[model samples]
Target: MREDAPVWELEAATFDADHTQALAARLGEQLQAGDLLVLSGELGAGKTTFTQGLGTGMGVREGIISPTFVLVRIHPNLPDGPRSGGPDLVHVDAYRLGSAAEIDDIDLENTMDSSVTVVEWGEDRVEHLSDSRLEIALVRSEGAAVTPAGDFHHNDPKDAGGRDGVITDFDEDDDNEERLIRITAYGERWAGRKPDLSVD
Candidate 1:
């Protein structure tokens, strides 16, 4: 079997959704047009949350949501932002796509050169679209409970309350769940310009 290609990797620990987004935002500042980001992770792993940060950092219009049903959503850069002359943000959810041909059908190449395309659940399926891409994987840290995407739910009421029947704010405790994020850069585009993941 062929070994995996050499890659630039960075491991980060993020607490809560906001922290994950902040990290992504820092990374987004380093991105430019024609960039492809492949995000791989399980459900409720903060994939969309990260994209939200990227959009914000890119100075795209607000309201960045998961394009689960629509399959793809485009957010244009602000007219006067730093990315004004750069590409737009193309957020894609490939969870429903069955093959790479289906991704090709989207004709992403049309905007590939002028946009930062981010594909969720697009690990093996979308690599063919670009020779160089950034691959990000988010995983829940050990002992951390999984939180729903975009929304939070309380844990067991019993756990939140003592025998005296006092209600506690689960959000405080739940927000501490840390996520292990791995970023890998592939191909020549990232040869000398690997993202600086040192930022907290």
Candidate 2:
């Protein structure tokens, strides 16, 4: 929890989409304006699903869909006064970008100080924007099975410690996969306090 520590890690396991969203909501509770979360995971690894939970937790407008085709989507908070006085949500999808410069071209810094920016496929590309961002890497569990409809099925019972097994790399085209989410916090913004990823 040292402020100067290079990185601090927290891990969690999610059995299904509902569990994954619940976990994201917990993390969202700790978020505030000026926060940046860089997400990395294969397609169908629940990146967009997690963001949906985050937006809901933040009390932002609904319909938080993937920004893949559009590249970025902004969700303004309700005026009723949300956590930390209604910070906006800036969701970005960097999968189609060729370089970090393209991210800069989006003028995200203009809104960085007042919005919680969550970038998918932005691990290496978006780090330059903030030194105090969170890096979340998700993987599908090996025990995940395929359903008759050709979708992945994860029926493992919930594990309290969220440390069922080692997570490995996965295919981008995999569908309906269960995820093992690893979150790493960097810089003083997240020094002592860590997001609670435990499912509620």
The lDDT values for all models are: 0.75, 0.77
For residue 192, give model 2's deviation from the true position in Å: 1.4
Worst ten in a row by lDDT for model 1: 160-169
lDDT of 2 at 79: 80
TM-score of each: 0.80, 0.80
lDDT (C-alpha) at residue 187 in model 2? 88
Deviation of model 1 at 57, angstroms? 1.3
lDDT, model 1, position 199 = 40
For residues 60-125, write the lDDT of model 2, one tens digit per residue: 888998998999999998887456476899999999998999999999999999999999999779
User: What local lDDT does model 2 show for residue 158?
Assistant: 31
Tens digits of lDDT, candidate 1, 1-200: 11235345555677678888887887788888999999977777778888998987788878998899999899999999866765689999999999999999988889888899999999878898888898888766665443433232223322422223212223322433567676777778876675654443
Candidate 1 Cα deviation (angstroms), residue 62: 1.1
lDDT, model 1, position 86: 55
